[model samples]
Target: MYNPTVARLTYRALLGRRRALILFALPALLILMSVVVRMFVGVDDRVAAEVLGGFALATMVPLIGVIAGTGAIGPEIDDGSIVYLLSKPVKRSEIIITKLFVAVAVTMAFSAIPTFVAGWILNGNGQQIAIAYTVAALVASIAYSALFLLLGTVSRHAVVIGLVYALGWEALFGSLVAGARTLSVQQWSLAVAERIGTGDEITSDVGLPLATTLLVAVSVAATWYASQKLRTLTLAGEE
Candidate 1:
């Protein structure tokens, strides 16, 4: 297997220094919100589920994914540091795979872990809500990372575009449009959660089998396409 040194460089750049703060912020906010909600509202599973669903899964997960996935490659591409990697002997496809791996890990760590902790704080595993959403967060992390990693490799405005898709399309449109629910990562993940949750605590517009298929398909396809895109990746200018 031809390894990618570019991938290593991409990981260092994405995770190093200032960008780590953005990664920390999202999860931190989730935890903080959980604490505040617990203090004020006491231990209510419904409120906990709502908070975790509305804020943690809907808002924090996507934002962290945008930061991790796009930041993994976009800044390098923008600043032309990608040229050094492009000029190397490593396979570009390997670069994408490596970066995708890093992005997914980062997303999982930042989003999934905190979501689990927050869920516990909110309701202490009541009706298995914490575990259910945690699983959903893990699943969502993989898809979000792959999608935004591809966006990063291809677009200069990947972060902005990713945020818009995550926030505007998924959060906003999915909320307002019943049909849009079928296309949402949030809803898809919720489908998985619904199976794990007791009663009607966690529900989704899509069914378990369909959501499972879409989640796996999207994550795999996006990762594969991202690797393909990176093989033909063109560096920006020396200008």
Candidate 2:
């Protein structure tokens, strides 16, 4: 189902631009803040949890997901360059799968790795805080990539829409609104982190069973829908 050529082109499209800078900047900020915090407060599990959960998983991961996932296909569609790609003999599903893989990889590298490094630095791996959030970032990467990729395929304003969802739904509503948490990729990934990480350092709004189911469902459904959209896609001047 995966196409290496499409994956290669998608990676080039994603990383060879200014969005690449944001990818680098967010992780750099996370690591920098972790060092400053550790130097000042010393090691504390609660502090580690706050840093990893509040910023890394909640903010950085989704932001990177928006950039990577939407950037994977949005730019091409916007520039009317996808017609060339669609004219290929490859199945639309393969293209979506390849782009999804690229998006997931980019998200994981830019978000999850930094979360782990920052987590370790925060508490020196105490209470397995770094590991937990890293796992959280990893799973969140997959779901966010698929979700935002669908947004990219379906909307011309994919990046803007993605930012609102990531910042608004995830960063704001998920924290304050009790019901929104269940629909959040952050909460679902936190469920996995809750399973792996020891201590109160990690928690989730939903249980493991429900979170796992939703995470898998969202990723599959989004990818499937994106494929369907691409299969029926029509560009300007098409007959």
Candidate 3:
């Protein structure tokens, strides 16, 4: 269920000079930090969880998601290039689906792979910690892509709004308020990691069943809503 042309365009748009620098920078920082931490602290599971959870999962993933997801459609819509695609015979849903796929792939590649490498650097995959957090990064990528894709479709300020949600809400409020954890993408993804990792170092506020349900529901609903928005998209005349 992919359109190759749309996918290619989306990939190019996302991997352009500036955005690619941003996408690569965070993961590189994460790996660098992992190496430094390993040198200083030696291999410890607690340190591994803290680094992965605090920086990789909390900061890097959402930032990359915001860039990739909003970048997939926001620029096209802003520059009026989307009108050419809209005027075509292709289904609106196909365009959204293809772009969504591209965004998810980019997010996973930039975020998850580095997370795995960082985890390994931290503990050599001891107690399955590296693999567990890698799985969390993978799961988080899907939900973040769909949600930010919908934001890109509906708002010109998609990146700002995404940062607010990712940083202000998910990080700040989720730490301050206990109830906020239940509604967090980070927590839901952590739930998956918790189940996979044997150690108690990695944990989540949400349960497995509830987390899985929320993950699936958010991804499906966001994609559906984005496709619907695309179907009804309007182009304004330049006065």
Candidate 4:
């Protein structure tokens, strides 16, 4: 459902105002860090790996996912602007799917592309690091978008919950607890990167087949569940 009108509305809300700034900010920071690292350290593949893995994939991608995914519907639900779309004869599922598509595209564009650029800048694509991380970024984009979009549909504190999941769970506990890595998008996508990259350059706690299955399952299930949630979505009274 390529709803041009819904797509247009989603694009405007995504790129308009302060959210746009955050969208630009993450990639800008990545490029800036890449430039600084290249200038001082001079194109070390290991450094490239560190920057991309530590910052780009681990941090920026998830942050952008949070913004795009949650932002796609959270504000609409909050201010009750979703009523405009709901009042139309359009199926609520169409609206959710359309918004989900937009969110995934936005997340991929902002996170994955920049990750590739930063990867190349840091190491000139040595050992296929750029392409590998780029692939992971792309895969992660889909999952993160679906998860956060679902968060938007059901929770008022979508951004907060997303941040906690991204930062606290994935970033913090994932590092500390072995079990946490199994449920992490960061680790799951890293598994993809691991398959593409050279020995030990990219590693993931999760395996390739499991990560692939989980990634696909999570994306599909979240998107479907979001559509169902949107069907019966109710706006809170302005108490």
Which of the two, 1 or 4, has more lDDT?
4
| Model 3 misplaced regions, further than 4 Å | 234-239
TM-score of each: 0.92, 0.97, 0.97, 0.95
| TM-score of predicted structure 1 | 0.92
> Per-residue alpha-carbon lDDT of model 3 for 1-239, expressed as tens digits?
68999999999999999999999999999999999999999999999999999889888888899999999999998898998888777888899999999999999999999999999999999889999999999999999999999999999999999999989877777656788989989989999999999999998999999999999999999999999888778433321
lDDT of each: 0.84, 0.92, 0.92, 0.90
lDDT of 2 by residue, 42-157 (tens): 99899999999999988999999999999999889889899999988899899999999999999999998999999889998888889989988999999999999999999999
Q: Which numbered prediction scores highest in TM-score against the true structure?
A: 2
Estimate the lDDT of model 1: 0.84
Global lDDT of model 2: 0.92
What are the candidates' C-alpha RMSDs?
Answer: 2.4, 1.2, 1.8, 2.2
List model 4 lDDT by residue over 1-239, tens digit each.
Answer: 66778889999999997999999999999999999999999978788888998888888989999999999999999998888888787877788889989999999999999999998899889988999999999999999999999999899999999999888876677656898889989899999998999756888899999999999999999999998888767333321
> Over the stretch 148-236, how does candidate 1's per-residue lDDT look in tens digits?
98899789899899999989977787656899989999899999889999858787889999999999999889888877776666432
Q: Ten-residue segment with the worst summed lDDT in candidate 4?
A: 230-239
* Total clashes for model 2: 0
Off by over 4 Å in 1: 1-8, 234-239
Residue 195, model 4: Cα distance from true site in angstroms:
0.8
